[model samples]
Target chain A: MTVIEDALFDLAEHLDHPGGEELEATVLRRINEPAPFDASPRSRVRTWLAVAAVVVVIAGALVAIAPARRAIADWLGIGAVEVRRVDRPLPNGPSTHTVPGSLGPTSPAVDEGLQIATAQRRVRFTIAVPRDPTAGTRSGVEVDSRTPGGLVVLRYPRFTLVEIASQGDVPVVGKLVAPGEHVDPATVGGAPGFWVAGAHQVTYLDRSGRVRTDTVRRSGPVLVWVAGGVTYRIEGLDRVTAARIAASVH
Target chain B: MHTMDRRSDAELVSGARQGDLDAFAVLVGRYRVSALRVAYGIAGSEAEDAVQDAFVKAFRKLEGFRTDAAFRPWLFTIVANESRNRRRSSSRRTKLDLQVRDQPQSAGAAVDDLVAQRDQRRRLLDVVASLPDRYREVVALRYFAGLSESETAAALSCPSGTAKSRLSRALNMLRAQLGEEVTL
Candidate 1:
């Protein structure tokens, strides 16, 4: 681990933002004042990002969409995504129903709620698929992909995907879960805790480069599984983009 | 457990959204340091300006906040963006006064060395200033400021994956830029 990581964990154990209430009062006053979108902070950055994205997109769409490529052309690793579409359609896959399992984590008040472990793993993965840009589909893919990658505990999650062969020359990995069809166990937590076996846990291989045995549990999307911790989510982007994102995980 | 009494972020935001200055104060109290750090990292020249601008913008647009969302990320989004803008417009550099290395009243400890370390951080900030805006933002957030992947994503208004990817690339760039002066 780098000094930053070590120091961060150490700091997490001792997170105390010490200061003055006068500052908070000042902040409160500022937030309540009226402002326009163009005059807002988000608009300014969006304007810059939009300009940059437009400029970069024409010359390097492949790289522009590739999240990690921008960071790691000579970054930590050689992140390459080959999301090629296969002419031969993929075979039929299993199906499942998903709803907004937004009940956060199981109650800490309940003694039998999700039991959490304290071990940490260096998480890494590559998401290599793109869903429609609709809010629902995009949200689902992004949340699910990134969920298990960060610090959180996982419960039983099921995924049934029909292989999506790319029309263009790109290598797609992992079966793409269908629209409105989500993996079973939803994510949980905001703290730095790892899921023992989370719902719809996105499995990652270890140092040995072998797909680890995935553990899926039996409860539905009950906060009962999350153990009241912070769960990070990863949504799926285009296949090429997914690969880039995955490769960037240190 | 504190969960029962601890109100949800949505609840807090709702109260703040209604012009409950106290509730908004709570939200601000909850996030000021992180917000300040984001501003300080990006707009050290006018870090305070970036911070004030972000808080003002957030309050002004309180009604637009989606009720179900968490406040930290939303607040961070405003702060992060403002930091970027401040950086572009403000040329003033942050003069970070190093915390005093309160050493034990012993003779063997190299207290001078600790002071040197402080200077190293100050120099490190200079090195950081030399980096591109994107890389600088990521380094400040991820390492110095200490934001999580999701938090950073919320602040940047980008996806978590995008945040991580950018952070990784940025860190690598920093490592390359500072060479041996700064270690990851």
Candidate 2:
């Protein structure tokens, strides 16, 4: 190896391996379990029939009404905001569902439930908190200081939570709002933000770019916005409430 | 256990393709550290999940893997692709840092030498981290993962010539960044 190659390997030796038996067990468990989409032969046939019935009905509706086609086409637009209105009520059950790409190991735990000031001191970047009293109490704050651009999550417990970090600190991939979730554009304290309403599947890529399946399936609405070179995700509130809470962040 | 360890990756991969979980588990055990390293180099904080996803995906698609092919490059390709997808989707780029805590300490004259070595390593890491995504990745695969040129090319899904050129370019960029700090 050349001098540069030798140096590269030497540097690589300093990286933390962090291996554990638990990781292996998790992989084994996941592979052994039946796939989420798998079902019995009879159930498969019934599902296909149900799907066919729905398709026929939708086709008849499209054929009967020309405006429906236009609406469908408009819904499939590739712009920032694409709207699709559902005629029927959304399924009712557990508000949270674990989508295929939803699970992954939790972010490295910082000292949880720290006071805002203490949490801020622990991280490199400034931590922004919602200034609104009605935004609820600051129940907890956690900081992951492992990276140069640290990650701070502020929790208001049941009311709402805000995750704040520098632009490049966290590698966020996949749709912020999963398929079948409703998303609309709104302003957070006059800055542009996305108001995602209803329970949605959130998929995040692990550092290696693999879909993470370890995150708890979040229920309820959220507001995602960026301000002052920081990305903020406010969760557990209605669209208007979430936006209002986001606006109050300082 | 020793026999399992002795089995080539291809043999294990063949067994894995036939629904042999033991074979797959052995493979995972063998490469998990290497996978984690490559993942960290590519995806940073998302390394754990990325490695898990890559392994699962590899298992699900094992039937498609050619028997004659080397397993490491093929697996690394999945990992690299996943990392790239993550980089694109998140629009967040992270540079890996060498931590002092992971290094061993020394005494007396060796202590000074160790300190200098650590500093050099840190500087080199910083320079590599500053490199553009493409160059950084080639370096990570070629140097960090210790893949041969042709294997790196296969992992990258590029021609051997292209891989060689990229490696040369990446090395030159690293040298430029390092300047007179270290001789290439």
Q: Rate the local accuracy (lDDT) of all candidates.
A: 0.41, 0.60
lDDT tens per residue, model 1, B153-174:
7777778899889888866765
Name the top DockQ candidate. 2
* Candidate 2 CAPRI classification by DockQ: acceptable
Candidate 2 local lDDT, A14-101, one digit each (tens): 7654445566666776665423121112232332222111111111101112122122223233113223333543233442433322
After TM-score superposition, what is the CA distance of residue A71 in candidate 1 from its true location, in Å?
47
TM-score for candidate 1, please give it: 0.42
Per-residue lDDT of model 1, residues A1-250, tens digit only = 6864553333322222323346765555334221111232233233222112111111111111222222221121233433222233222323221111212333222122222221122223222322323213211221221122322222222211111111111111111222232323222222121111212321121111111112211221111111112112233233333233323322
The docking quality of candidate 1, as DockQ, is 0.11
Q: Would you estimate the TM-scores of all the predictions? A: 0.42, 0.51
Measured on C-alpha atoms, candidate 2 has an lDDT of: 0.60
